[model samples]
Target: MTDTLATAEIESTIRSLEDARYAAVVAGDIEGFAAFAHPELLYTHSNAAVDTLDSYLEKLRTGFYVYHRIDHPVHKIVVVGDTVLVSGEMRADITAGGVRKQLANSALAVWVRDGGRWLLLGYGPTVIPGAI
Candidate 1:
């Protein structure tokens, strides 16, 4: 496929993934979140903590962390071959460790096309310190 066509395809797929993630968070669907992630997906936070998909889910389940909603908007997406990158902003309403709070952040995601599926390989986010 031509680079332009490939980029378009990847961008569409990435947009779908982003939408699904937003919905899953609002629904507090762990299964849905798992489907959006690769088995070994590496997620990094602004604080530099990294977690595999499984580990991240474990923290959510075991800690009784409930993510009720995530208001994230994709600003831009760029694709080069098998790698796709996206930049966006997000606001999340979460309940964790007995505290209910809302937070906002800027996020970036990197996806790789493995086989025929676009898998989330890496994601990072910077918390907007005082934005709620």
Candidate 2:
């Protein structure tokens, strides 16, 4: 059975991984990106597109979506059983389908603990209602 309570230490790990994920995307580090994602990630974007882990990684690697830089602030992490949920604000410079796209977002990510390691199992990021 999975532990329902995550220690403050575990919570710290969660935050660090969140930082690392955005960093890896900006760096275009394929291995790092893959390491951060779980086998069955279901990600929904602010633009209303949805992807599984493989599809998402493929698009990133191919420049279908280019992540230039990312900043996450006001993030909160909570744990329930083996699942970790994160909610936050995101700002970034990005391109989608060869067009520069707005990047301000309100994001949520779900990470699952598997074999004692945390892997991002899902992501949903909604665009901020209005922007420059």
Candidate 3:
């Protein structure tokens, strides 16, 4: 396939996966979210707290982190061989550690092709100024 075509295909797949990920979080589907998560995933929150995949999942399962809704608008996607970098902004309504909050964040998500599937390797989100 041509480079352009390959890129398009990759972008589409990544976009779908991203959408599904958010949906899973909103729906409190831990297993669904886990399907896309890499074992060594590193997730850094807007508050600068970090979680590995296991910890993140545990939090989700225990209701320590609950997502009510998420609006994520992807700004860019760069495919570098088997790795993909996604730049986006996320606006979310969530409850973290029993405190409800609305968050607007500039988010970066890294996905890596593993075997025949793509897995979320890392994610970091920065709080947007005055967006709380």
Residues 61-82 of candidate 1 have per-residue lDDT tens digits of 6755677777888999988777
Best first by TM-score, ranked: 3, 2, 1
Q: Please, what is the whole-model Cα lDDT of each candidate in the order they appear?
A: 0.81, 0.86, 0.97
Quote model 1's TM-score: 0.86
Q: On TM-score, who's better, 1 or 2? A: 2
Q: Which residue pairs does candidate 2 place in steric collision?
A: none
**Model 2 lowest lDDT segment of ten:** 1-10
Kindly indicate the candidate among 2 and 3 with the higher TM-score. 3
Q: Report the C-alpha lDDT of model 2 over 1-132, residue by residue, as the tens digit.
A: 234344576788889999898889889886798898999999898879999989998998899988887889846888877888999988888898999865888999999999888999999988787753
- Name the regions of candidate 3 deviating beyond 4 angstroms: none
Each prediction's TM-score versus the true structure: 0.86, 0.91, 0.98
Cα error, candidate 2, residue 102 (Å): 2.5
Alpha-carbon RMSD of each model: 1.9, 2.7, 0.6
The candidate 1 region of ten consecutive residues with least summed lDDT is 59-68
Best by lDDT: 3
